[model samples]
Target: MTSSRLAHEHDEHVCPRFHRAIELVGKRWNGAVIRALMDRPRRFGEILEAVPDLHDRLLSERLKELESEQIVQRRVYPETPVRIEYALTQRGRDLERILAEVERWAHRWLPQPSKS
Candidate 1:
């Protein structure tokens, strides 16, 4: 095969970093949760409300995962109830354009969710 064909063939192979990124972003509800937070910082309850059918326990787990990845930051406020909020870090916000493109592609090509 020619060098250009060889290069194209090589590029067809899966990339480890790209695979890791897809796993992170495409994990169950991770994309939804991140998209919800794209607007602004939100309390745990608020995020729960934004994402339908997300259980509190699972949300907690997902937030912790994101936190570990440095994609989400948790903040504590000194209040009577000790309020906590979650916001996307710069790393997470950097995903906005990518996620938005995915959103657009989905809208164009993916089947629409059924209205129940």
Candidate 2:
């Protein structure tokens, strides 16, 4: 068989679990949250500010879901004032290349609206 066919056959045999993962990451706000964390770890409020238009409830839900999926890590610092920050896990970092590609595609094909 040709290499291309072999690759396609291999993908065909793969289970739906992998597809489910993609679906989860592909959820609307999930990708943005991952992209934001790609820059650096951020606190809840910092993420909220970064995604100003996102509703607070939705952000909380997304963060919790990502955490449950082992895609994000929540760290709490013990100090005079407690601090919490969210950072991407190894699995989440794996999305960087994919996200970059999507961004490139959007810039190339998605049109900008008129200023008026």
Best candidate, TM-score: 1
Q: Encode model 2's per-residue lDDT on 3-106: one tens digit a residue.
A: 99879977778647767977998998998999889999999988988874788899999999999999999999997799999999999899899999998998
Off by over 4 Å in 1: 1-12
Please list the residue runs of candidate 2 whose C-alpha ends up more than 4 Å from where it truly belongs after superposition.
Answer: 1-6, 10-15, 113-116
Tens-digit per-residue lDDT, 71-100, candidate 1: 999999999979999999999999999999
> Pairing residues by index, what is the TM-score of model 2?
0.83
TM of each candidate vs. truth = 0.88, 0.83
lDDT for residue 42 in candidate 1, whole number 0-100: 97
lDDT of each: 0.95, 0.89
Candidate 1 lowest-lDDT run of ten: 6-15
- lDDT, residue 97, candidate 2: 93
